[model samples]
Target chain A: MSHSVDTWIMALLTLCVFSFLYRDNPFYRFAEHLFVGAAAGYLLAVQYQNVLVPNMIRPLGRGNLLPLVPLALGIMLLGRLAEKTSSASRWALAFYVGIYSGIAVPAYMQAQIFAQLADATKPWQPGWGAINSALILIGFLTVLAYFFFSAPHRGLHGASARVGIWFLMVAFGASFGYTVMARVSLLIARVQFLLRDWLGVLPGA
Target chain B: MDEALDVRWFDPNRINLLVGLSLFILFLFVNLRRARRAPSGLYIRTLPALQALDEAIGRATEMGRPVLYLPGLGDMSEVGTLAAVTISSRVARRVADMGCGLLVPCYDPVVAVLIDSATREAYTQAGRLDSYRSGTVQYVAAAQFAYVAAVTGLMLRERPAANVYMGSWYAESLFLAETGNETGAIQIAGCDQVTQLPFFVCSCDYTLLGEELYAASAYLGREPVQLATITAQDWAKILAAIVVVAAVVATFFGYTDIDKLLKTS
Candidate 1:
């Protein structure tokens, strides 16, 4: 009995969320506010448990001083919301930027440029590796040629980027198809609700 | 009447089932009244979103301004990036033809290069190969706020007449939209961020909601088969909703055997 009642209450909550689609009625507004409050409350609780307690309060309580670094950094991030003290936030920003840039800039060059171009170039080695590599190289070169912006398009760079146009077209086409699948899946999930869950009719029925 | 059993209301599956059924019913009404088209037939239609390039480019030409297009925050895995590229292809062609400037600031380097190519190729395709600007498409830092700052700086420096935003967006959606708004540009935006839809609606002149972003090329390109697929997907939605409602009803009212039989089949 309780199981079914629980199902009903959950249904009611979900229905409240979906109600927004019909021009934001009172029920939908209620649901939206409830959701916002719940989300905020949950975030506060999680941050307290995960970051504050373990990373800050616990350390200070246990006489561990090293945790103060992260504790101070976290506090500085809050300075961004304040007007006068916002300049102090830059120290945190610069710290993050330095660490992030250190990791990202090199990773991008090595991964996107060096690795992709290398793999694209070394197509004809010895075995199937040669075949796949050749294909990748051809595709990359053609696409690169299609976008060749630096030099005038009188010769090979011009021709390669033109081939790049075809590769780009194919990529866009595949992306389009996949996007449709995703949209259809969401629509299907919603529609399935109305059918099996609400009406309770199916193959067996 | 056991309180312990009452706590079962928080069960994820039970909640999901009820919620699903409710939404399915709601969409049934939402889709039923709109238009009547055959399921299998194809219809080609044009949306002004494509013409937006012509307008944006024409404005840039008239005002001697640049056009700024940002491919959202996500990398290539995002559908928004692909949509932005397709739109950029058209915009680049127009900008090339009009002899106006184009600026594309991208979050992802891979996507930036691709967008740059798409922009350059648009010029090449338009026979304005000489007009294709190498500096037109460039990468900004990948961090969310850093990318936003970089894009905002470009908008301020260039002072574009028209801003086009297409792709996956999150927290930075409003930041970009609001910045574009401040610049007094005619902003045309499309995104799949359901949470950010309201922001776009409030800030942008033309906003594509939810699945509309995915249907952009088809609507803008006026492709018949693509339109047909869109219709099929709509019908598929109806079919899915009916199934959900049925599942919920079976799961309720002590019809466990019926639900099991339906599931097995």
Candidate 2:
């Protein structure tokens, strides 16, 4: 067994969380609440040190006025706390949304649309590659058809859209399988930590 | 031979992108004008998940249990969060109209404020301002698993009849969904996160996949400008498809011009 106090506390919390698999209980609730409260406190401290201190406080202390713009915007965001000043928060929200949208639109167009189209339109090699290329083209077109809201799915469009659904389901299945494997790996890691690090039962430990 | 690297203020290679964006704007403007002239003539296909939203809320109202909504763990910068906020506004409005209890637990403080504002507006719009509760939208935690823990705890304790999750999600999607499932809540989840879609699909009653999440506001709002945006997006997709086909055809014929033209860098 581990003699370290931190290890003991962590191992117990892990067990408390695992208890939820059987059913929700006081131990699990205690662990959950503790984690949430600790996390919220930790986040506040980290943000103060990492973000507010360096970006706003330190800069202002150094007589840099540029940071004041963002600082003012942030304060305005806090105006939502009171009903009388709540509408004032919209200016900050609008600025944030507008800047983000302007940046995202061009980036999305370039990366998602243009880059993807460029790759999809690349020349195929020979033989089997050509067949794979054809499949890609068909899948792309059919999926696009499925997402076409303006057009009603009927006849040829409906068939293509149906095929698109099949493609989507296959994708979802593959993703689900991949994610399950990842979760299993995580579970194995936790089990290893419990057995080796805590109990010192594993060969290396 | 020595050659100088031609560097300019702007890369000419991205001209194609500029042209495409211009066309998109043109389509949006034209569609907006058309939609304003005749909003009723436009047709948008029914999204089953969005359609089920009302049904989910109604079930919660009938069961006399609060409807829980979690706008996933994303800040305002994310488009998914914005879309989620829009849908949450609609949900709040409906909940107010039906005189049902509503709960919205938030991950981001900024998003909490946004949701609080939206919910208050929704209640006011529905003439149920008195029903608006101060603590309806609460900021739980910034950490992902911590937020999930708080939310799952709430779900178990409150036993909300309908659980609505919208926006960007991560690994906690399943944790939230499965816990809600255990509580026997009618779950309707929508997200743009590709990896979390399967979890929602398996656990929730209805799942909005990919672009469907983005389209929900436009579909539900049915306002002329919003519907026009949907139509414009369709047109943009059509244009992209045409370009892809043209480039492929051109490439098949040993002409690499179209391919090179589309390249970003």
Candidate 3:
């Protein structure tokens, strides 16, 4: 109930986790198991409280027969834990997979492929933005051409795909540069932590 | 200002200083008295493995086989992806030197483009201006398994001598490693994802685990600022650990009042 006790408890737990860094000793092992156990227990409690009782049983009790479908699905999902009824879990898995695939496939197609093409093709009207747009179009067409698998390597589409390949190459190169900066930042963050907080020799601290 | 800093239960300033100092002293002692000799590259203030990366490429070139570089499954926003790309720059340099073709398969569009630039820059820097081919780097599907299938196909088709997998990965870690193994390529992998390490360790020749993935840039001497940051983070971890032990011992001995005071203070 007390915030101070809670804080100390958290600090102890954190220390247990950090203990692993000093060569995987018993303290780290104990902490790791404790964390796994606590997490599983908490998840179980939350599921029962949040999902099963309110969404299924309560609705059934209120005479909404429509709740039977969800109730059945919920029970079927629990089949995963029982060897005898494990086959029933397949339906639940299928339902989940179907929903996920339905949402993801279309979303990815629209975002990564078509949208990129649209952005790549906007005609420039003799301004800086237009010039950039034209450059982007050239890059996209050449890069896309390079990736072309179905069409012959002789026509305008082939030529555009080649250009798309070029754009893609440049894009990947820029991405590589940005990635260098990001990784370097993480290393910098960690070093700063050690020097400023751990060693106290770093002047900026 | 003095009174404002003197809150007992929740004094951020004092707690920060105490935690900072405690960790600093611990590591200072450890580093000073360390008698255990680690693997030559692992214990150093600066990384030595990075230097050998060029050698890996040279060997690949002598063998007359393509080099396979995987930028991982995530976007450039991921720390692991960034490390992979940074390492890729070095690898690209070596590949250009050898005039060996470099094949980079990307799972993210943004990352795909970034790697393309890095490949070109490395080639240009090596004075292989005309050698930079756009087709060498390509984007596979963003779907994890689809990306895996495409990469596996490339691995089979190219039969690269050296395989480098770096960045954020998930279920496909084993798939890529096992495929690379089948081709008998010298595979080096690095990932910050702890769950994927066991797979990489089992499958790859050299595996960089956890924080090591983040340290790649520093290891390669990319920036001095990164070295400073890592030192600071390590200090924070050590200080936090000591406070934890003290709290536990205090609680066990029924010094609940003292623990409470410390926590609240």
Candidate 4:
């Protein structure tokens, strides 16, 4: 009876969410509000358990001064809660933004810029790969040219940017196809859940 | 075996680093030199999606509905989030100017605070401080799907006429855009995440592709340094293309020298 009740609840919630397809209704609002409240509550609980207890409460209780640093920053961050103390939050925001920017610059340069350049540069390997390799090189160069907004995209530059658009369109198209498949898979999963878990009309677990 | 991966003060074997660093320094130098000169000559090619910002806002004004801005789920650590913040400031300015409602729902409290200040400042600067509502910029939820659900619910309840999504988005990208679409709102979306680009393209009336997000932010900010960086990055990209061409040529002829120079971990 308990299992059947749980199944009914699950089915009802699912239907509440799916009703969004028709139009936004009271049921959807309930589901959405429930989700937001639950998420916020969960995050608070997790932070208290994983972060506060482990890092702050326990360490500070044991007379360690280190946890005070993050605690101070956290308090400053919460200053945004009040309009008067809001300016104090900038100190923490700046600290975060500066550290992140400093780290991200070199990281992006190495990971995104340099690594991509290396892959694009190595066009020739062996066998029938030559054609694909050339296409990649051309596509890459053209795309790079397209992004150069400082230059006047006239004559040769215009032509390359145009080609770049075609390459980009093809890439976006392929991505869309992949994402559609992913979407369909999500649909399939939900259908399976409905059939097996909710209705018990499918095979046993 | 791991000797090749030894940490060094500076590894001479990694020529890619040298080249990248050189290019970066050179870009800085060029931008510095250019900054000393007239700003009038600095030109960026037109991006249609960026231009649609005003149009979308106008649509909302006409419909007597609010403009909803989703700064995505990215925290401040990501440049994408900063870019989104920059864009939000610009949108807030426009909305303030128009005396129209603008709602920014944030997944991060820190960002929510930052966004609130930006929006408030924009209103103040526009001499419309009275119109600035603190509740307009709100912290919704930290969790991904939760944020999505809350934003989608807001879209439904308010029936915002223009929905703007910017920054780093994930699976929630399509759901947000599609919800806005269903609401008959004119949606404009931009993200650095390539995977989410296609979804935005499908559901959004205008979508900024890749670094256009950065470029748009810079364009909107109108900060000389940011503008300089964008142009400098362009020069670096051009130089990168040249290097790629040379490297490919050398590789075609079975020369390992160029290959060695370009190899990175």
Candidate closest to the true structure, highest lDDT? 2
Per-residue lDDT for A45-101 in model 4, tens only?
998999799889998899999988878888998887787998888898788778887
* Model 3 chain A: worst 10 consecutive residues (lDDT sum): A113-122
lDDT of 4: 0.85
Q: What is the DockQ of candidate 3?
A: 0.01
lDDT of 4 at B187: 89
Question: Which runs in model 4 stand beyond 4 Å of their true positions?
Answer: B1-19, B257-260
Predicted complexes: DockQ each: 0.01, 0.72, 0.01, 0.68
- Please report, as a residue range, the 10-residue window in candidate 1 chain A with the lowest summed lDDT: A114-123
TM-score of every prediction relative to native: 0.45, 0.96, 0.46, 0.93
Report lDDT (CA) for all predictions.
0.62, 0.90, 0.62, 0.85
User: Model 4, chain B: what is the TM-score?
Assistant: 0.90
For every model in order, the fraction of real contacts preserved is 0.00, 0.72, 0.00, 0.70
The candidate with the higher DockQ, 3 or 4, is 4
What is the lDDT, from 0 to 100, of the residue A125 in candidate 3?
39
Measured by DockQ, the strongest candidate is: 2
- Could you tell me the fnat of model 2? 0.72
lDDT of 3 at A74: 61
RMSD of each: 22.8, 3.2, 27.1, 2.9
The parts of candidate 1 lying over 4 Å away from their true place are A1-205, B1-41, B44-53, B223-225, B245-265
Q: How many angstroms is residue A138 displaced in model 2 relative to the true structure, after the best TM-score fit?
A: 0.8
lDDT tens digits, residue span A151-200, model 1: 34557666765676576556545654565576579768765654455544
State each model's TM-score restricted to chain B. Answer: 0.74, 0.93, 0.74, 0.90
